[model samples]
Target: MDEEQLKIMRHSCAHILAAAVTELYPGVKLGVGPVVDQGFYYDVLTPTPVTEEDLVKIEEKMHEIIAKATTFDREEIGLDQAIDFFRERHQDFKVELLKDLKEKGTTKISVEELADVGDRPDTASLYRTGEFVDLCRGPHVQHAGQIGVFKLTKLAGAYWRGRDGNPQMQRIYGVAFETEQQLEEYLVMLEEAKRRDHRKLGKEMGLYTFSELVGAGLPLWTPKGTLLRNILDDFVWQMRREYGYQKVTIPHITKKDLYETSGHWEKFKDDLFRITTREGHEFVMKPMNCPHHTQIFDCEKRSYRDLPQRYAETTMVYRDEQTGELSGLTRVRSITQDDAHVFCRETQVKEEAYKIWDIIERFYAAFGFELEVRLSTHDPANMKPYLGTVEQWDGYVAELKSWLEEKGLPYRMGLGEAAFYGPKLDFMAHDSLGREWQVATIQVDRNMPERFGLHCVNEHSEDERIVMIHAAIMGSIERFLAVLIEHTAGAFPAWLAPVQVRIATVSQDFVPFAEQLGTELVAAGLRAELDDSDEKVGKKIRAAAMAKVPWTIVIGSKEAEGGDFKINVFGQDEDLVVARDQLIATLLEATQRPS
Candidate 1:
């Protein structure tokens, strides 16, 4: 189903859930029922804490309500009647919401913003099923019975209206699908996702850790995690190097004047970490590297021949993210970006972008990700928020669109999604579980160059304005690794695995041979780990396998005497016995970059 249709179904399902909850607990006050990605959740104030076991009874009640095949009748009432209606039902949460809407003089709501309440005063639409009523602007199913196949997944505590120190409410989450088969497929995927969840696997595999003492949203990489990150960094550097990108470095913090010149101080000052020196100079942790890269470009003179000076860096940027918004590597305060910027003549914009597209394709293809393209353009209704003039915006947007068309790339146009400075081409990738993520991005910026007054000598030996290209293949290294870990289930490919090969001898007699083999592999540019633990060889092999090593080498007496080693490849049955010379050659070739 399309997103809109799916959202309608999920929202209908949420109403049924709320109705069931209200019936089960007479005094429950309804907060809100919103349809989120993958599911829907309803927040309600209950008399007591709702545990996981309560979900069964609630779900059973929901099924009963659905079986009744009751109609969902929508009605429009006066602001005061709506308040009185919810007040008499003991749904103070709903009554409070209506009061806010009434005070804001809300008279109409857009169909697109059906679930977005409180943010703006809009029309108040109410829906009723049987005797249960809710204040919502909904396009629900024709009847309660048409909610499709759904399952209550979990429960959590949420504050009323999402404010801290507010009354806590029980939020029940569930998944809904159009058919039973689709629901089953989604459930199966959920099971696999749980098994592959980075938060869980990272701990079990010793990949990374978090401590309250150090802080939240800052991950401490273990030896294994650091190895994986380093390998990824090397690969990205090599790829960018081939694309004519030169490495550069910048300080983590800069004087406030730097951002003020770049417009970030006015736009994102609140989202930055500000510091004050004893001398009273204000500094802020750099939230992005594009501004810093531009200073480097301006530090030197350039001509048309020097156009497309691509500078690349893998550096960490800090943002003042709310603590509650923090998750594992996916959402963090400190983000490491594989960031690069290109300063080019206006005539070179398309070529520079083409090069960036190639880099992005090669990087994601290396990991087997499928991509979708989007051309994010300016919103004409609100030009005041953007930095450049309408002519510059329209001209660059037309050029980008023409370039995309000339290349015959299928892309979706996103209105009002452009950065405040310029348009961008965003690439969304599909992971192993069929979930899509916004990955690489290439943004065309004329504003920053103008702000910095960047220029290059044209063919006529006259100063001309230049354009900037902001490219990030791996948007955030931490977020990328989190997705990668979950996508691969921590079983990284042979070339990327932290421990490429694990060697364990059958007994003390073969220990020396195993150590020699480990040394050989290491010398051949492989990450080899020798199992020197006191565990038996079988147990050691199992441990290595659990660690997700790409291969495990067993050194037995036969191998020591016969000069043949057995290699057990991960995710494969049966072992292959080959001469040590042949194995070393195979590993060396396997680890090298594909030509």
Candidate 2:
């Protein structure tokens, strides 16, 4: 089925889930049920706590409800009547939502589906499925039978309206598809995803670690993990260097005034890590690098010839992310952004953007990622959320759109997805598992320059307001590593692998030769290690395989004397036999980074 139809089916399944839950446990107050990326979830305050083991029972009840083929009847009632209906039923959450809708006209509601009721502020829409009624603005399927195949995935605790101080609710998540086969396929993919989970592989490979004493969401990179991160960052820097980008540095903390002047203090103040000195001066750990980059640009007076000054820095920015929202490397409190900003004339916007685009394409291409482009533009209907005037926004968006067209590249428009500063080209990369991730972005920003009063002298000696292009090849080193680890299942390419070659000896006699060969490999600029521990060759080979090293060389008596080396490549069925010189040459070739 189409995407819209799938969303409808999933949303219908969510209502069915809510209906089943309320029937099984009466007096449960309902919260919003919204359709997410792959499924739907409903937040409800239940009388009894739910656990993973209870999912089977919930799924059975949902199945029973779906079997009845109950029609989903949508009704519009007066706002006061709707509030009274939910209030009588003791669904305080629903009543609260209805009251907010009545008082604020849906402006306060963050739920996209419920936001549709704004057109008729005096009335609210409700959907009835069997004996259960929910406050929703929905275009549901005709009946429960049309919900297709569904399975309740899991349950978790969530705060009401996502605010920490509010009463917590139980969130039930489920997935729905048009057919059983699709559901089965999705389940299989989910299983594979778990197996390829970056956290699991990272621990197994000894890449990184976390400690409670060090705090949550903060990762301590092992030597190998640090190497991996450096390799990735250096790769991006090499590409950026070729494009006339110069490295720049900035302090991690700045006075609150820097952000206030950049408009970030107003928009993202809560996310910033704030600090107060003994002198009672307010400071903030930078949450972003662009604002700092602007200061660097403004430090020097510039002529038109000095336009397009590109400054690149890979630095960590701190954010006070919610504890619950923190995940492994993907959602960490400390983020390392390979950020760059170009201060250029308005006419140079397209050229600078194209340069960054090329860098992004080349960078992701090295890892075999299939990329899709998205043009994220501001919502014209809502001007309050953005910084620029309507004409400026239109011009900036048109420049990016025109660039894409001129390059003959296809992209999808993401309305209302633009950053508050300007429009951006978001590059979504498809990993080996067919999952899409937004990896790189190139934004054409006129707002930040205007806010900072950044300008350059034109040929006519008149001050010309300049534009800034924000480019990040790898949006975050930590998140990109997470994706990369999962993409390769920790078996990175030879050049990118932390330990490219692992040398293990069959006997203690071969240890000397193995060490010599390891030294040779290291001298050849290959990341090599000698497994000289008193372990059996079989066990050593297994350990190397577990570590996902690209190549493992076994040193036996014959190999110690002068026999051809037997190299066991990861994920391969057979060993490669080659002379020592040939093997070294082959490895050197394999370990060469992409040019």
Index of the highest-lDDT prediction: 2
TM-score for each candidate, following the candidate numbering: 0.92, 0.93
| Strongest candidate by TM-score | 2
Q: What lDDT tens digits, residue by residue, belong to model 1 across residues 1-595?
A: 7889899999999999999998998788888899988789999888876789999999999999999998999998887888888888888888777886776544223222333344654446789899888898888988987788999998887777655567878889999998999999999999999899999988888988998898988898999998888888888888788878899999999998889899988777767999999999899999999888998998988988988899999999999775645778999988999999999987888888998898888888888888988899988876766897777788878988997899898999989888889999999888999988888899999899989999998899999999999999889999998888888898888888888889887778778888887888898789998887678988987888889988888888788786777888888898877786699888777776542
The deviation in Å at residue 125 for candidate 1 is 3.4
Expressed as tens digits, the lDDT of each residue in 470-527 for candidate 2 is: 9999999999999999898888988899999999988898888888888888988889
Off by over 4 Å in 1: 77-123, 157-168, 389-391
Return the lDDT, model 2, position 30: 84
Error of 1 at 376 (Å): 1.9
Clashes of each: 3, 0
